[model samples]
Target: MAQTHTVTIPHFVTEASVELTHLTAAYAMYGTPHIQPDGRSNILLVEHALTGDHQVDQWWGPEIVGPEGVFRTDQYCVLSINTLGGCMGTTGPGSIAPDGQAYGSRFPALTIRDLVHFEAAVLDELGIREVAAVIGGSMGGAKALEWTLLYPQRVRAALVLAVSARASAWQIGIQKAQMTAITRDPHYLNGDYYHTEHTPQQGLAAARKIAHLTYRGELEMDERFGTDAQTGENPLGPTLADSGRFAVESYLDHQASKLVERFDAGSYMILTEALNRHDIGRGRGGLNKALASSTVPTFICGVDTDILYPYHQQEHLARNLGNLIGMAKITSPCGHDAFLTETRQLVQIMHRFITRIST
Candidate 1:
């Protein structure tokens, strides 16, 4: 019989002997060591979706990281660190500040670059100077882009999926509307409402509803729930008390409630607002100029059905990446969520790319 033991992993702050100025920052790991007999490791860093946790393979499903999966844990070490401003184990508004209370709305404004910095700190602590590849989709993809830009030497290649170089004006507009809903909520309590009276569950739910629509395509929505009526009573309206709600509305409600259970309102505001501030060009010059600085080879992928980041964005990034070696756009009806849905296609492409590059 095999013996079982419990072990505590070392924190990055302790390992590096450095102080993390942020109120919170946590990370998780997966797979066996990627070290060769010579002692060098091939590492894959996966960035997660907006509400995603560090359990990448688990959340996205085992198809992406199992023994026979594209990532092939037996061959390479995989790391998926929750973003800095996330409500996960990582530091964020929900974390208690130095003042011994939650940072709340006072959490420092963080950008994708800032999240990359946190990841770099983790890598440095782990003595990993170079990663075999960085992979991400949607918000995760944004972080992947920043990683290549900020640490060109450390990231050998980046796989950007269903994401743009910068958040578009339309993206900003939608995010702003979501923020407005949260702020306008009487239960928000100006963000310090933690342990006070009420939480902004309703407002956050509304935001999730809007975001879920963007995550899927119009065709998908049409196919899933065209004009079917929900059987539940209308809670928002006494007038609709007799009439049935649309199936689409029911689906959105399900997404919203799911988010409400695991997500924090203040953190949502902070992260989404930070996403709005996402731009590699901010201080480095412009988008094209910033990307030109990266010496890393890039693998840019898009979903043919993605409306949020759209396929053109990936094409533009590939054109500007200079050292891009692979470009693919998987066809799926799932839109932005296709990356999570179509693992088989991504697996084949990634396996070839990783093997070719490692050789």
Candidate 2:
């Protein structure tokens, strides 16, 4: 297991012009950074998804971040930092403001660029001159792309998996609905529920259920659950509310309950909204123009069964990236989550791609 660390940024500003007096960034590092006199090493910056913490090993699993993982400490320094609006030991809605109270609903809106800015701050503090590669899947993928576009000089290559250059309308709609589920919860109390004994866990759980449906593939769900009720439970018990849950329902319930335990509803809303605002082209001209500006080498991967991001999005990226290292696909029925679960496929791609980039 990797240990996490924290750094307090003296001052920070958001793209929307919101200035934060202080920002605490949580991070984890593995292996020696650089041995050369210049004090720079081949660094692998692994970003996490929406609800992920700095402890990438916890969510990314061992195959990727373990001691003997792909980006092993023995060969390179692996760095991970929690996003700005993250709640896992980072400054977020739950963080206390200079006024000595939790920001809660008062936390300012954030953008994907803001996340990159937070990351840059952490790197600057650590004196990391440059990174050999930046890689991630899903929301993490978005950050990887931004690093190439915003600071290509600082990154040699990047591998973005399971994400588009911009959040699609369909994705934004889903996030909006999930945000509504949280805000409408009676216990939410309009984002001021922090001090209250009752929280919007029910709302968060509902939101998670909605989100999980998109994270999984349709065929995967069908194959796993079908019309079957959870083992020993009756789907037709006469009364719907009193009836036993379907296998699919049980799966979603498990996903939702698990998220509610680890995530804050307020942070969930903020991060989802941030993803909704993710557009690499915004103010940098059109999508193609912005993409053309990223001169760094890049490789992209997609999952064929990913209904949320879809395979075509990856193709779009391949077509536009300035220096495409080639694209690979993960053949799986697990959908978007395949990026996380399909370790063997991922290892094959990284082994091929990172080997070239690092060399």
lDDT scores for all predictions?
0.78, 0.88
Model 1 over residues 1-359: C-alpha lDDT tens digits? 01111122233232124344543445566666565554356788889877887877676666677566678777777788777778877777777766788877666666777778778876776667778889898889999998888888778788888888898898999989898889988888778877676799999999888888788888988998887767664434557555657878888989999999999988898778778888878777898888777788888899998878889988889888867878888888888888888878888777767876787
Off by over 4 Å in 1: 1-23, 35-40, 232-242
Candidate 2: RMSD to truth: 1.3
lDDT of 1: 0.78
TM-score of each: 0.90, 0.97
Best by lDDT: 2
Clashing pairs in 2: none
- What C-alpha root-mean-square deviation, in Å, does candidate 1 show against the real structure? 4.4
Off by over 4 Å in 2: 35-39
